[model samples]
Target: MTAHGLVIGKFYPLHAGHLGLVRFAASESAALTVIVLGTVFESGSHERRADWLRAELAAAGAELGHVEVLAVRCDAPEEYGTEIAWVANVAIMRAALAAAGRPAPTAVFSSEPYGVELAARFGAEHRAYDVAREGHPISGTAIRADLAGRWSEVAPAARLDLATRVIVTGAESTGTTTLTTALVDHYRANGFAAMPVVPEYGRDFTYELHAETEERLGREVAMDDLVWLPEHFARIAERQNELEDAAAMACPLVIADTDAFATELWERRYLGATSDETHRFGTDRLPPRDVYLVTDHVGVPFFQDGWRDGEHIRADMNGWFVDELTRRDASWVLLRGAPEERLRYAVRLIDALWARNATFASPPWRSSPPSVE
Candidate 1:
């Protein structure tokens, strides 16, 4: 008789430790069913965990031969040491199997102690997996608490929440977008898939303003107009935050051209006061970024395309950024000199950060990336 096995977990972030138990059961059983039990009050959404679990199972390939992954939104009642939770969980399992025309599990497998008790209720055998945490010694809790320091423990789907976001920002014509786009390409070519680029939302939004004002009105937008007219910045901030967060899920490092904070700075400079809605949105909604690279405007060629501001505004805003960073004592570094020089210098800083926190399980990018100089 072929053994049908079951494994259950919250998979809060679905680290390697959970994968080990799933893989172990796969090797031991003829067919395995993995249950990702989620509640209304879990850290990650049920839909997200379901998607991540499905991806991992498919990626498991022949190593986990016949397998299925299931996600349930069943909320086990909160009662310490009560069978209410266990009973509820078992009911879901039985109902799920029956609904699929499969039999009740012949064996229950798990890395935790509950497997024995769970299996007993179904009159099935219990097989304890790596209860000692021998193979992959990591936990979702540990991953959640210190995500930057524990990047390798998380699945790709969970990375958006845990990955380090490096914001490249400065005044127009400072090569901010150039560096951001280049870094993403460099990482992908060098074997880091999650290095998605969050293109400059503010820059794109500003271009629209310039087009409308300069072409239609046939006049350049004055500083007073930007400062006093407050609505557009708010929309840009919300959009920028969305774009950055969306890009974070696929890669370990998010290389943003500029984040909302940079947008806020420009709003402060051009508009005396930013819209309250946009300011609060950036402050409360956006996650804390890992670092900032502000490109220096000194000696850089300032091109005045029909849409761009003059070199004077670019230079003045760059000084304001430097001053603000000094006041806040934030995590930041200056990218100065030629294009090639700036790229190389910024990569070196990021490379050091990657090395210090790397766990060797996450993909590596330590080799020298192609230099432009």
Candidate 2:
């Protein structure tokens, strides 16, 4: 008979220790189920945590085969060591398992003392691993208390979602790419090993479209020759968001030359109004952004890199960005002056953004007020 193993936790933010526990359980069972229990108070939703769990398991490259992830939401008061709370939690877990079509687990694995009773309630044997902090020496609480300091302890899958996303947007030849590269370099030099910059996907899309049009016409296609479509802008916006998300997974600091949100502005600039399809694929799908850096067109000569419009419309383009960003009440900084000067101010703004991201909101379970130093 095959033994089905179960591991459950809040995974407040999945960390290395949680991975270790799940890994150990997977090794011992024919099939394993990881339950990501969530609460209304948690910042990460149950589905999001499950995504993180799936990503980490998938990264193990078959070492964690036959493992499934599910989620259970429980908002009952977390009164530790109380019979009422334990019973309530257990009922929620059983209901979730049944709803998910999972069988009764033969073994329940956990690092908490509650594992004993949790297993008993399900008629499963309790298998405790690393009851002490010897193996990973980290907890969700500790990780939450100092998220940035313990960033390495966080599971690789969760890091991407938690990363600070900085997006740079501007009119043609306004140094958006220049500032993006500079900020990425600055972070890498400042010890951010995995700082990655997502290049503008719109340009890539435009190039492909231009090439395709030229091939069809059997002639060199001018920038105007490329016909823009609402669906085309939607694709660009969606891809831009995808690229940013993928780059964010590599490290905590992710810089994007442009993002899905920027795609909407580009759509309006070309089409006279933002299409429903573009808007749907743009800001609606954008990941939470820390700040938007708008590069100023002043003093920057347009290079007209063959794909770009002329300098005459550069101010108009910049104005669109400023107006839209202001209307949305989004956090943004206008970068101006020479490259070096622009970089200096950009660094200060990003430093503040990084500091703010590093500060984790206190979990709702903590009843006492935080001590002020």
Candidate 3:
């Protein structure tokens, strides 16, 4: 019944210092569980912080089998203090372990002011590492400042990937697939790695819905019986995760055909209506992008694929795409022309992007790195 060690933190942007502490804890304990404090503030969501922590851990070789990442929501104002926060955190951890039917932890790992006091309450051994001299201590305040446009002072580890993974998004047959493929090829030919987004589960699920709900006289179609009124957003979320993981493994640039944002557009347009859940998901679930390539109406002919709507619907979808991009405050390049012409424009835009950007330094952990394949 001896439990593993626990490391609790907001980990707003898990940097080198946090990783060092985690590694220290892991070496000292039988196992290490990183408890990420969630819902601490309305500024950044729990999911975003958790994702950032997971990726940082992965980069630092701490995402091994022994380490577990868990999130606990702490929305109450009282949960921000030392003792109360520790009690709530311990209770949450116990519940989480019980739910998983695992042994309770025997130690708590941290370097914050409350480390010893918090450990005492659980009757667990406490280990404190000094964060002041550990690694590069780039705090959340500094990171937010950098993200607000002060890039020069940002730590190297805190910077985003120089060459971004951009997704070309739109409704069905809005040239997303075509543009994505062309961009990948263009980047590859120019001696850079650009991968098209692999179609995720939602596309397959949508295809299935089409096959079931509609009859194909000469083409595939979704049946009317299987409408979008009762669609679940879980499929979109699953796909988004898959895409993110794929991009992480990819080379300099990863181009996605469509993302969760595109799915939201379709759901709102075709489904009965959008709800608070859908809106929140759209607001939070979409990945942050360095740049967004939006294809405006280029008078391109709409292909009548099984899932595709008509020209009028396509135009309407374009408006929705613009609106969503505006809402997100994303800087975008509006590509307009025939499919091939649009492809050419995308290539030019990419050229501009690369010209203005610096080369990406190879991540320390990546071995046998991918080339433009």
Candidate 4:
């Protein structure tokens, strides 16, 4: 069937405001041409915006079969006047429709002032839908602002799937705990599920091996150098295995405070010079992490107690940990800057990765099980 009307806009996210226009056009026309204009611009990628718009329309109960979402590229001169720019856009839209073997639309739908003029140029019926009155209008400006923490609002149908697991690593007194807590808060506040690593080894082994030490050796010795010894490495490894197994069984998205690889770094640093056995035990142990995040030494002045090491060693150890993780062929993201700013950057990176993963609909082989002859 031929398209009865055409709708044009960037539709960066196709939120509730855009839904009103689509519903209005659907009532007047048998089929609507949802032309996604200026798709080739660098501001917002066409494929990214198109996918979001498609999902939004589908959720709004619009018929995918009758709704045509077209991505048209326009390259008009920068010095051109508004009238000339409109003419250029019209030419591009007409060509796009002709290439798709569809007739020109009878009416045009838009909420912008330019919509009326574009409709007149195409000799099509003009209809304006009020975006501000309808509800939340999803624009790039508003989305970016929300991300920057100016507002606590997000799109109702916003995709909150963070596919990658974030693993934070550092020795004690390096602000690892602070960073993990901050990340969890940031993600959870933004409507994503983030699980924190509880370090079962410290509690489990403490009760088993160090339980008696706490009574005999006292709190200072038990909490200090003894916990960093080679004998305790086995319990640490076991705890790490438990966490990894649980994460693998649970969800693909997780945030771990410290992984087994980081534990290995501690073993090498604390163990004596001739402790080859301890090094071998740590090397053979530990599971692979998807992405390892290392924090920089910006002199943030972290608190240190009797059990904690100096900032110099902590900073040096962080560098060695990153190098070792890299040598093991594990992907890593180095987080720098202030605590909140770093958290924001990490969240944005995770969001972008998740969005990319979502873009891949499905593979051909996965569509159906192996066909029998």
Runs in model 2 lying further than 4 Å from the true structure: 1-10, 16-108, 112-125, 130-157, 360-373
Top candidate when judged by TM-score against the true structure: 2
Whichever of 1 and 3 has more TM-score, that candidate is: 1
Q: Candidate 2's residue-wise lDDT over 1-373, tens digit each?
A: 2399999887768888898998899999999988887767666587888898898888897899789899778776665568887788778878888998989899999888768877898899999888886998988878777675677788877887788888899999999999999899998888686666699988888889988999999998788888999999999888887788777766677888988877898888888888887898766667878889999999997897777878998899899889888898889899889999999998898888777766655446655311100
RMSD of 2: 5.9
Better of 2 and 4 by TM-score: 2
| Model 4: per-residue Cα lDDT over 11-31, one tens digit each | 543445566677677777788
| Candidate 3 regions with alpha-carbon error over 4 angstroms | 1-163, 192-196, 200-202, 212-223, 352-373
lDDT by residue for model 3 (194-215), tens:
3435564566786766665555
Tell how far residue 113 is off in model 2, in angstroms: 5.2
| lDDT value, residue 210 of candidate 2 | 87
**Per-prediction TM-score:** 0.57, 0.71, 0.53, 0.48
Instruction: Tell how far residue 295 is off in model 4, in angstroms.
Output: 9.0
Error of 3 at 305 (Å): 2.6
For model 4, what is the alpha-carbon lDDT of residue 71? 73
lDDT scores of the candidates, listed in order: 0.71, 0.82, 0.60, 0.59
lDDT of 4 at 288: 37
TM-score of 1: 0.57
- Provide C-alpha RMSD values for all models, in order: 12.5, 5.9, 12.1, 13.7
The true-versus-predicted C-alpha distance at residue 82 of model 3, in Å, is: 39
